[model samples]
Target chain A: MKRGTLKSRLAPVALLAGLLLALPGAPLRAAELDAEQQARYQTLINELRCLVCQNQTIADSNAPLAADLRQQVETQIRAGRSDAEIKRYLTDRYGDFVLYRPPFKAKTWLLWGGPFVVLLIALGVALRFVRARRAAPAATAVDAAALRQVLADEAGDDARRPPENRS
Target chain B: MRLRYLVPALVLIGLVVLFAVGLRHDPREVPSPLIGKPAPAFSLAVLGAPQQTYTLADLKGRPVLVNFFASWCAACRVEHPFLMQLAAQGVEIVGVDYKDTDADGADWLARHGNPYRTVIADPQGAMGLDWGVYGAPETFVLDTAGTIVYKQIGPLSEAVWRERVAPLLQGAKP
Candidate 1:
């Protein structure tokens, strides 16, 4: 019984190890980012798109351009540049197209606000649906007998009600 | 039933929009900084034909296509026929041999039936970096004023040359 529990616990760990082993390609070489810098850089890279590949973010891509961008980010971090400054520098060199989360200005409002606008419309439709469903019962007539019984039950539940009111 | 049809219709519209955005992107027309800028000057000698030298100064009066290639490059081989076609169309072509031996460049040219008017050797790739060449077989089209108007990063196809380069030769601004 004890062995069974141990086997069940070890099974997932073994399975995970096997899966990692089955994956092709060697692991990426880890750069020297401290805990604070690592989190910051990770967040930054996730936001920045790889210029060459365009579709993939620098954090997710293994292209040479992505690697160069990663190194540039690390170097910038070590030099004490803020995230905003770094992003600005990259955008200046590679255009607004390089950014995955494009800036909120004249041209990119459509990209930024499109999803929220869609979500708001969806919410409005859902609310209307629920409201219409709630009003559906009102459109149908209630049974008189059932309504009377409900009223009687309510009257009986009150401590001030007499036995005649229970009916 | 109406909502079901509406869902599919919405999905279809979304898919169409997605496809439209995907296909709308013109990767080939990504503007080069070299556009409207003067071609970098170089007076390198043609490797095999030692007597012939190529320079930006010489190509000042007419449209010239500077094609950077290497004998060892596979993409350059793919573009060989297109280069020949361009030559057949009476396009003046200059070649920059990137990091290749003189004998190999000459033999490769001999085998490929040399399409270039002049070929210069850049065995160290110094000139290549100066011209912002990350890889081989990049072609730059220079106008009469010696300004680089178009830069194609990969092997140029006959269709691509006709679509992108030929118009520029006919006096298109970019």
Candidate 2:
């Protein structure tokens, strides 16, 4: 009974795994790549963005264009093109947008640095706010003293009143 | 001290304005880098007549408008009449039936009134990749020297043809 239950549970998982593997644009049957080439292939695909499905990497997209691009990448890899050459080839044709991680350059300096610049500005503002708040306690202390004096004067006025008026 | 909060508020408002402006423009209309560069070479079979092959070299030494289209694309159908008009006006238009079956492409051209001087078949879209074509109904205006002068991303309209492409062709002649 235990064995049967386990097999039944494994069946759907195995079927799902098969469906995932059969998805279009998923890497085809493993090519005869050595360890180094395999690593490079993974890196290249992950770095390249799919133009059709802008949100996905070429490796992750199921679009026909992505499949074609993958085939092109594999062909280039087989042709002994270096990783840099392949990246340059795609970028030259498709522009820098095809890269998931765009290169740091003069034009892209703002894209790369804008976040850090904003963060720094925010930090400066927050620091100033904290410092100002810290310094505000002194002013608040003077206000508290005035409040205490008012309370004492109110108490004196109440004490000076007649017992019937107090009642 | 209150002004410190104003800095972030202003930045946020500025970003919101920038995003609003950006939303007005089509994000799919990425400018091609191939403009002002030499057109990519291609040798593809004619759509109906597979025996005859058309090459990019055959149309050299003259301005040619290369259009990429597919039977499956609705925008291509919409642009068909404009292309036919341009062809009638003595414009040499080279058609690339991108990633479409030969029979479907041939049928579409016949039904829509073929506008191309010569039609090439890119069954696998291999040549389309060389030209960095992301979608269908893209048109490129190549100068006499085989340099790509201008590219239009969407379906062609009469206004666009008159405003942008007409001047380029006239400028190319003498």
Candidate 3:
């Protein structure tokens, strides 16, 4: 057999063997989740912040606190609690820091609304400049021509009419 | 004009100065949640004396410093000498063995020379959470009232202990 064909045939098997070897210490019969609950739990965990570790979502952090929080979520899921309830339970225990998207409040108003306000102000300023340029003499020549036509019509009316008494 | 640029330039410098001043505000000075509040309840078996249980109530009415550690935690080993120094200074030091076997914890204590008054074993790590521990080698300083006055995350340096704890020891709010 050609070496290339042999190596190609062996690659997938070797990968499978490596994967099996890597999981030797893993527990048999690992916790199983129903499809619906598994998807909900995954989405919930991805949104949650790992309070103990900096810059890691709860799903990603390996910190003990993160593990506890993850287990707590799993327990809530097993209990048939909704995702909101699970998040509320964790936030209650760990404070607002546990939330990745902080709730809009007096202190957090700027955090939530600052970007939109900045965009609106930028758009307003841009529109003002655009309007100003459009209103400039070169662009407003059409309006200037209309004004000239009105003035010329008045001059023609005066010339056509018998001269009004000098006033 | 050059002076127009100077105004924004000065404003930028002023903002930089303000930001620098804001950055210097230390989180350690913020009163810890564990301060003035009852120490969280914990009951873990003693690492060396396995049959005995170490509870938070056991250390009430005394100034105790609980050091959370693990045999595999390198920072814990780094700060071991500082803990010994704290012990020598008449501060009663207790240890919490975090997620480590009692045998390994005992061996580590023996090898490093134990400065702990009692070493609590948290083999399953339930007790560590009760104390709001994030990682290994976090030290909590408690007052005579059993309230946790300060918590030092990561390795405890002498400078941090002195700057953050000595004032609290002198009866100031952390």
Candidate 4:
């Protein structure tokens, strides 16, 4: 019985090990580049948005299109294309949507400055709230004495009342 | 209402309106910047006809409809008949067989009537990449000057052809 339980437990682990072993090893490295070329290639891919997988950069995406684009970027880099030139080439074909950081233009003004505008508006509101809170105490300070008098009068009335009336 | 509160309320309304408008349109339908710009230059050999080459220069001086297709793409099959109909209507359609095997592309064209004036074999999708074709069945309408005037990202329906493409072709000098 002990042997049976041990075998059952080992079976899953063995299967898991087998599955892990079956998985393809490290990704294939197709290109040999110097450190500078590698760095530039990395930066370019990181900056480029994968059109197929909208959320991921080309470097991070596993989509076939992303792989093709990575190859294209590598080729462009090897061909001594400037980063700007490479970006311009991609933008010309895929439009500005393929860029992670879109250029500042007339149409993109809202996209670029929208957050700051919202932040400023939020700060203005917050400032107004703080000012209102600060000003509120000043207005209530005059009523403090009157409120104390009212409380004292109530206490005196309570003392004068019979036990049954208090009840 | 106080002006202070009114301004925020107005801003909120404006934001809501903007979001509503944004929501109405499909985000995937990004307008191509190539529209109104000159078509990308490419010189590819005609599929199955290695001797004949189709260059962008050949497309100049005449309006052309460039259609990207693949045998593996189901949508391409769906649009094949319409493309044939357009070809029958005297539309000069150029085909880009994207990333497809030569044999399969030839067989596909044979099975489906070849509606293209010349089908360029883009086995590695090099030309398709230059043309910015994300998916198959993308069609572009170029004016006589080889300027891309209109682009349809999906399969071309009769309605789209009659409404959008026909008008553009009519405006172009035959």
lDDT for position B68 in model 3: 91
lDDT of 4 by residue, B130-162 (tens): 988877889999999999999998799899988
Q: lDDT of all predictions, in order shown?
A: 0.78, 0.87, 0.76, 0.86
Residue B145 displacement in candidate 4 (angstroms): 1.6
Clashes of each: 0, 0, 0, 0
lDDT of 3 at A37: 81
lDDT of 1: 0.78
How far residue A17's Cα lies from its native spot in candidate 1, in Å, is 8.0
Lowest summed lDDT across 10 adjacent residues in model 4 chain B is found at B165-174
Q: What is the DockQ of candidate 4?
A: 0.56
**Model 4 spans > 4 angstroms off:** A1-30, A136-167, B2-16
Over A1-167, each residue of candidate 2 has an lDDT whose tens digit, in order, gives 99999999999999999998786546642386777777788888888988888888888887889889888888888789999999988988888899988899997899999999999988997998899898875643457876776577577856565545532
The best candidate by DockQ is 2
Q: What value does the TM-score of chain B take for model 3?
A: 0.83
Q: After superposition, how far is residue B87 of candidate 3 from its true place, in Å?
A: 0.2
Minimum summed lDDT over a 10-residue window in model 4 chain A is located at A24-33
Q: How would you order the candidates by lDDT, starting with the best?
A: 2, 4, 1, 3
Pairs that collide in candidate 2 are: none
The TM-score obtained by model 4 is 0.82
Across A82-115, the per-residue lDDT of candidate 4 in tens digits comes to: 9999999999999999899999999899999999
The DockQ scores of all candidates, in the order shown, are 0.11, 0.59, 0.15, 0.56
